[model samples]
Target: MKHYLRPEGSPPVNGYSHAVAFSGTSVAVSGQVPVDAEGRIVGEGDPEGQLRQVFVNLRTALAAAGAGMADIAKLTVFLTDLADLGAFRKVRDEFIDVERPPACSLVQVVGLVHPAFRVEIEALAVLPVESVQPG
Candidate 1:
């Protein structure tokens, strides 16, 4: 079963939920962009800056679902340029501290929502039983 998350005072949704709550032992978060805590785009013209922002964004999303980087099972990264991949990997390690990191995949894409944006990361996590809290 799946439940949508829409906290009070949050903006209206067009056709998608900010996240979905599931009944399994783990929770999974969808792709998160470089949008900041206030929902504004970050690192407008820089790939490295944008990559860091993506991590921040993912952390925020994971927290909302009662999960964290340690619980992540996989991360799929889409990039506009292959040359910028090293920077993205460096930034990713900074946020994820587990010795055995989650599975990861990188893909080169022509473009994203905005041309200035060079990266986007989507994550899937397994919510440990200990991490789940009763609402």
Candidate 2:
């Protein structure tokens, strides 16, 4: 169960809500990079490919915590280059709901720990009691 909020005075968000509210157990997914379960990087010099791997990692993290993409209330996206914003949205919508998207914060940074990583994402999710067990 979740509710999206767009305060009257707030600027409209294109791909996400201004705020979200939900009542349930919460889980924090640490910033996920392009690396996979075996610690091998998937994409290099490819923002879209890196983004896909990032979302996959995010999904895995949520699953481990007894939650899924639909349960996410908020997301923080980091990219070294803002030019890929359009590309990011295209791939992100594949995983998250377009109508009931989570609140989001996207930002550009100088660089990530690894030069190959162009995108990283972290999420805060709320899980319903019957949906899953504890991690």
Can you give the TM-score per candidate against the true fold? 0.75, 0.91
Question: What do the candidate models score in CA lDDT, each in turn?
Answer: 0.73, 0.89
- Model 1 root-mean-square deviation: 12.3
lDDT of 1 by residue, 40-65 (tens): 88887777789999988888888888
* Number of backbone collisions per candidate: 1, 0
Candidate whose TM-score is highest: 2
Worst 10 residues of 2 by lDDT: 126-135
Tens digits of per-residue lDDT for model 2 on 5-44?
Answer: 5778988778898889787788999999999889999878
lDDT of 1 at 37: 74
Q: How far out, in Å, is residue 65 in model 1? A: 0.8
Q: Model 1: what TM-score?
A: 0.75
**Residue 132 deviation, candidate 2, in Å?**
5.9
